[model samples]
Each structure stands twice: as C-alpha cells, then as structure tokens.
Target: MRMFWGAAALVMVAGCQAAKPADPAVEKAWVRLPAVQGNPGAAFLTIRAGNKPLTLLSVSAPFATRTELHESMAADHGSSSGAGGHMMTMAPVKQIDVPAGETVKLAPGGKHVMLYDVAPGVQPGAKVPLTLVFADGSRMETQAITLAAGDAAPE
Candidate 1:
C-alpha cells in the first residue's frame, strides 16, 4: 500500500544519512614556538571527556617531523653539575587519560606535547594543524596558534 511504501522510503532515507560526528573534546589548543630554531617546541591544551573516558594516544603536527607526549617533573637535583637547586626533568609518556566529565591540562611544567625539529614556517602568529589520536582510533583535527617567547597567553 501507499503507506507501506512511504514508510519504506523514510527508512531508506534515514539509513542513507551519515551519522553525526562526535563532539569536540579539545579546547584552548595552542603551540609555543621554541626559543631557538631547530629546537623542540611545545603545545598546550585542555581536553575534556564526555560520559566515557578518553585516552590520548598520540599527537601529530605537520610542522614537526616528530611529535611526542612528554611530562615535566621536579626532582631533588638535576643531572647537570651546575644545577644547584631543584631541577626539572622531562621524559616521554605513552598516553594521557581524560576521565569522564573531567578536564586535563597540558600546560607548562606538566604534561605536554613535544614538537621536535619544528619547521621555520611555524613561527609566531602562524596557525598550525594538530591532530589528536584517541585510543578508539578516532582522530580529532584541530589548529593551534603559535606563540613566541615571552608572549602572552592566547585568548
């Protein structure tokens, strides 16, 4: 009947529709240009999770040939001989967990993404691309505003 055909058409149309993309889980993403060229730069951001936890597996930026996750920890003394007082140690980390309904900050002197051999084009005032890969294999594409040394926080 006509009603059956109409229902079938509606079901077919709904099936053809694409699923809505996932919600954005990143905010306040920005990159800090390295003080010296050829040195590693740093990227900071805040990540939020929805009802389920999300694991940030890795981050990638075109400006840097190699990108990795790292953490800065304060220890009693630095390995360097000249380090008299407390020194900060940085090491690579595998992943960062963003609990449900929680926010994790990737800021200075904490967990952050290290961009190695950053390209010269990624200078101050430049907007670069950053991709965050989660544990579920879903990738979130985002852009980061570059900041120079002594530059104020990005708005």
Candidate 2:
C-alpha cells in the first residue's frame, strides 16, 4: 500500500509538469503600413522572440515595384553642434537579428523597408499582402493595410 501511494504521487506530479504551456515567442509579429506613391515609401514591422534569436531574411509585397530592407542613420554633424541633422543613407538590410525575450521595432529614422517606384493602381484603404521570410526557412504572410498618400514617415 505504501509503494502504491508513492507511485500515484509521482504520476500526478509528472502530469502537472507536462501541462505547462509553451513559450509565447516569435508567434506574434506586426508590420506597420508601407508608404505608397510618394517618391520613396517605407514598411515597418514588429518582431518578438522569446529565448531564441530570430533573423529576418527578406520581405516581398505585391504593390511595390521593388522592395528592400533598409535602415536610416543620422548624418555626422559637421562639428557635432549642428541644429538641423542630415541623414546618411546606407545599404539595405540583408539580415536582421532579434534578441530573445524582446520585441524588435521597425520605425521611421530607424530600421524600415524602402519601396522604390510603387506600382500604379494601388490605392488607399486597400490591403497589400506581405510575405516575411525567416532564417529558419519559415515564412509568415500578413496583410498590410494602405494609408492615404503623403502620410509621411511611419513611427
């Protein structure tokens, strides 16, 4: 009888341990809206990683003539005392890393997607399909709703 009770307790403890939930990581990602028909447009997305680092490989959109990952950097002030800052353009982002247990934010004056020569016929209030590729060979597709033209840079 003593052995039987001990075995039962062990089995109950094992069951409780197995009921733990999975880590909520890299499952929820949000991409901000992209600019349209205003010279150059930008796309912003949010990435979450928990206990595992993630890489953003590439992005594709239907309405853009060309899409590329890009980042904006403030130009070096002539004497580090200039009031108006200049922007120093750099190459597109080929790979991005998202640290574990944090959210990577893509915003204006930071990391963003640059769309050159947006395709015609893409109108406001329309949603464009965006496919994001990951380093693990997994892809996630989401619809990025369009905003009115000349909305300016994204946050």
Candidate 3:
C-alpha cells in the first residue's frame, strides 16, 4: 500500500505541472521609407503566436523617434460627395492580440507600426533594428529591411 500511494503522489504532481509556453515568432519584417523627415513611416510583418496567445504591447525602432501600432481603414464619406474617391485613415491602437497557433499579419492598408519623426538614415536597402514589447514583459529584437517609399508590399 505504501508503494502504491507513492506512485499515486508522483502522478498527481506531474499532472499539476503546466507546460511551458513557446516563444513568439516574427517573420518577413520590413519598413517603408518615408518621403521626408518628420513624415511617418510604416513597418509590416507577420507575427505568429506560440503555444499561448500573445499581445503585442508596443514597438520601437532606432530609426524613428516614436513608434505606435496603427490600423488603416476606409473613411466613411457621404455618398453624395463626388470626385473625392475613397479615403483611408489610420488610427493608433493600444495593443494587438495574436491568437495561439495563428499568424497575425501587419500589412499595408491594414495593421502596421507607424514610425514618426523618422531619422534621416532610414532609407532603401538599409537594415533597421526593431524591438517588440509584449504584454508579458518580454521583448523580441529583430531587424527590418527598408524598402523604397513607393515600393509595394513584399511577396
């Protein structure tokens, strides 16, 4: 009976232990070159959550004075207006949630990191260092390739 009780205790202890979460992954990170100083630039990437859900708290880049998460959406213009076409606007977001086992894409005309007061050194073909801060107080450092201002989204 003593041996059986010891075995049961070991099994219970193992069952109570939770599995460790996997680290998040960042891929295809790229930054758009700004037209001029003081103009905001944009960064796009694909983020994949690990075994658990992840929240992207903020983003920082050495090339920009300030960075914030932003979402671009079509503006609601009254139907009667003519010749203006459709307008798009971007708004800042506090945090972005990446679901577990799913990939969240930050692409043009969607969700992206807005870089304000861009430094002069940020240009096409330049490699920019970026840091991604998570809600869990963890940070991921990565680099993004800079593309021309008029360049389209990378394939």
Candidate 4:
C-alpha cells in the first residue's frame, strides 16, 4: 500500500509540471490622448508571450467607455498621395494573435486599441488603469502611462 501511494504521488507531481503554461507579460503600456479635446484616444503597448501562444481578446480602461482592438492596414492604392499610392485605413479586429516566445508591439500608425469618450483626467503623466483580456479567460490588470499629443512612448 505504501509503495502504491508513493507512485501515485510521483505521477501527480509530474502531471502538475506538464500542465503549467508559459508566463505572459505586458510592458511599456501607454495611452495617447487625442489631439483635440472631446475626440477619441488610443493606447499602445508591447505584449510578450513566453513559450506559449496567446490571443488578445480585448482591452478595457476606466477612462474610456468604449475600447476596442484595431489595426491599421493599407488600402485603396488608387489614390496618388505619394508613397506608391498607398492609403492607410483603420479596421476593427476581433483578436490579435501573439505566437509563442514572441513579442508583439502596438505602436503608432499600426495595431492599437481605440478608446472612445475618454475622461478628462486621462491626460499626460497620468496613470490610467487598463485591463487586458485574453482568449484563455485570463485577465491582466495594469496601469498605462498617459502621453500627450506629441509626446514619445516609453523606452
């Protein structure tokens, strides 16, 4: 009986180790205020998926009533405004996939989160609370620094 119990305990420990997932991290989170008052805002950040694939479901913030995952893609090459007749367009994305052991950046003029009806207090130098929801039903709560219209992102 003692030998059977030991064997079962060893198997349980091994199974626990095998079931562990990689650690995920969010860094350099910052919010960019709108250029004009009462307009919408945006947020940028870097997501690191360590040794496991991840899907970013949505972003929510206390300052904005509506937040969404969005992407900027090139469209309508017929227009000739230079740059090889390429025009930028914003599209709503349901989710953003981050591969295993990779880093995805949400930067200016690229993939980012759109914030609507932002509050007045979410100004430069302010720390706004942000919640990142993942497809695995995991939520990460972090604070994002606010940047002015012309301010640069964090290093």
lDDT of each: 0.87, 0.67, 0.88, 0.89
lDDT of 2: 0.67
Clashing pairs in 1: none
How far off is residue 133 in model 1, in Å?
0.2
Model 2: runs farther than 4 Å from truth? 1-38, 78-83, 152-155
Model 4 lDDT, residue 141, Cα: 80
**Candidate 1 stretches greater than 4 Å from native:** 1-24, 78-84
Residue pairs whose backbone atoms clash in candidate 2: 32-44
Provide the lDDT at 61 for model 2.
Answer: 78
The digit string of per-residue lDDT tens for model 4 on 32-80 reads 9999878889999989897778899999898898999999987876676
Give candidate 3 misplaced runs (Cα > 4 Å): 1-23, 78-84
Most lDDT-accurate candidate? 4
TM-score of each: 0.79, 0.67, 0.81, 0.78
lDDT for each residue of candidate 1 in 12-119, tens digit (9 for 90 to 100): 887766343344488889999888898889999989887678899999898899999999998775557655766788999999998877789899889999999998
Model 3 score (lDDT): 0.88
Residue 22, model 4: Cα distance from true site in angstroms:
5.0
